[model samples]
Target: MREYNVAILGATGAVGTRLIEQLEKSSIPVKAVKLLASKRSAGKVLQFNGQDVVVEEATPESFDDVDIVLASAGGAASKKFLPEAVKRGAVAVDNTSAFRMDPEVPLVVPEVNEKAIYDHKGIIANPNCSTIQMVVALKPIEDVAGLKQVIVSTYQAGSGAGQTAIAELDHQAQQHLNGEKMTADIFPVKSAKKHYPLAYNLLPQIDVFEEDGSTHEEWKMVHETKKIMEGDMNSDAVKVNATCVRVPVVIGHGESVFFEVEDSSKLTPAKVKELMQNGAGITLQDDPDNQIYPQPINAEGSTQTFVGRIREDQENPGSYNMWVVSDNLLKGAAANTVQIAEKLVEHDLVRVPAEYYGK
Candidate 1:
């Protein structure tokens, strides 16, 4: 078995910590593990394979002799250091939205488009967390019956925003319970004019709103779904629409997805259930009689995407509806990023290009 030296950027973050855990159980044999983070996070200890690894401040030199880089740092940090890591001979699997839409970079969902990993020029972008699970649930349907459209409404967790948002949700919940004035910060777009509490309430917004009145999170779902499924951002084959909302939940994300098939006569609820039941990385729980269905609470720590409530739209026979749930930090972000690295190794595409080595 060959072992590769791996580096995890943003080692102390929510997703970064999960990456460390996944790597411990991953099939990829790891020769060494390096933990990199911001200056403030340097010296913090994180456990991996039963050993404590100290976090180091990330720099171009950190990629020296590194084979794989799992990057979960913010967009700015990824945009700055990922290229440097690639230049030094490490294949980077990025979790931020930094390079997802770049023509030179491959935005991949392993189950949906594993072949796209080979097209990478030293970097592979992991689709947004929300997009990752939705595509996983829809890929089987798309394969069995050609997909024509996707409309999704997400019930996203506080963890999607970051650790600070998670803490704020908890703090606000306590304040609301005690009849104290709740403080609003780090939510509904922290830089926006108004901040809202995500405790005991839902905010119909995830990221900053675009001029077209769609949130950035919604646009990512719209654009990323096309790129991951069809391999082109401008593909008109599958039209996607998303409505993202931030709920008070702490770990899992749930989505209500309605999809239309090109060949309506061949697709049915029972057939869709059968496809989902046999699909990779998917669990079917569609037993309406027994009240069995996917939920965020039941999906908290699992890597598999839970799908249920399979049925066809009464008004539109061509369209069907299903519910999808998964651990946003694991499968949605960390596990998916690690899976891309594993695919690269499986296909023997792990080596840095000759032109990028040492330059």
Candidate 2:
């Protein structure tokens, strides 16, 4: 196996931590693992291959000699370090909203758009967490029925908000149980003065609401889905609408998806199940009599997208309903980002002129 040096930017974040864990079990031979984060997190110890790897402050020069960089930090972090990593000969797979829409960057789901990896100019963008699972569940069906439109509602987890948000939820829950005045400091919108309880409550907004009233998270799913499926956002073949909500779950993001196909008579629930079960990056968990289905707890730490509860829409003849679930930190971000790096290697798109990554 070929060995490659790897870097994990935003190493202390939720997705970043999971990315390291996945790398531990990955088939790719990792020569070295560099953990990069902010200056405050530098010197922090994170375990890899049973050894403690100290986190270092990230800088444009940090990518020297790195073969692959899995960046799950945020849009701002990606905007800052991606070019730097690329300049240093490291191919970056960013798990942020930064480059998904860039005409030059391929927004990929390995199962659906792995070939797009060949087009990477040193950087690739992973699709949104909700968008990733939905596409995994819908891709096989689209191959048969021909998708025209899709509407999705996502139940996102607290972990998606970062670690501090998770702690805030736990703190508020304990206060709620103790009959004390509970406070919310990390939800609804952290920057927005008012926060709310996530436990025993569903917050209808994920990111800050835009001028059009849709949250940025919802818009990311809508636009990113089209970009991933069709390769261009302007394609007329796909139309999507999404409502992103935050729930108290610590892991998976659950999506209730409704979709319309160009032809319905050619497909059925059983056929969908068969295709999905055999599909890449997806696990079909649709047994009804045994009361089997995809749940958040069942999806934790797993990279496969879980899909179940598939049924035909009663109101619309060519429409269907299904539930899609996944470990947002894994398949939604980390695993997908790693897969892009692997694809870059497999397609020979990564190893550019060494000077291409140098300052």
Best by TM-score: 1
Model 1, runs deviating above 4 Å: 232-236, 355-359
Write out the backbone clash pairs for model 1: none
Q: Ten consecutive residues with minimal summed lDDT in candidate 1?
A: 229-238
Per-residue alpha-carbon lDDT of candidate 1 for residues 32-132, written as tens digits (9 for 90 to 100): 99999999999998888999899999988999999999999899999999989898888999999999998788899999888888767788999999999
Give the number of the best model, judged by lDDT: 1
Pairs of residues at least 3 apart in sequence or in different chains that clash in candidate 2: 87-357, 87-358, 88-357, 89-357
- lDDT for 284 (candidate 1): 94
The TM-score values for the models, in the order shown, are 0.97, 0.95
Model 2 misplaced regions, further than 4 Å:
232-235, 353-359
What lDDT would each prediction earn against the true structure?
Answer: 0.90, 0.85
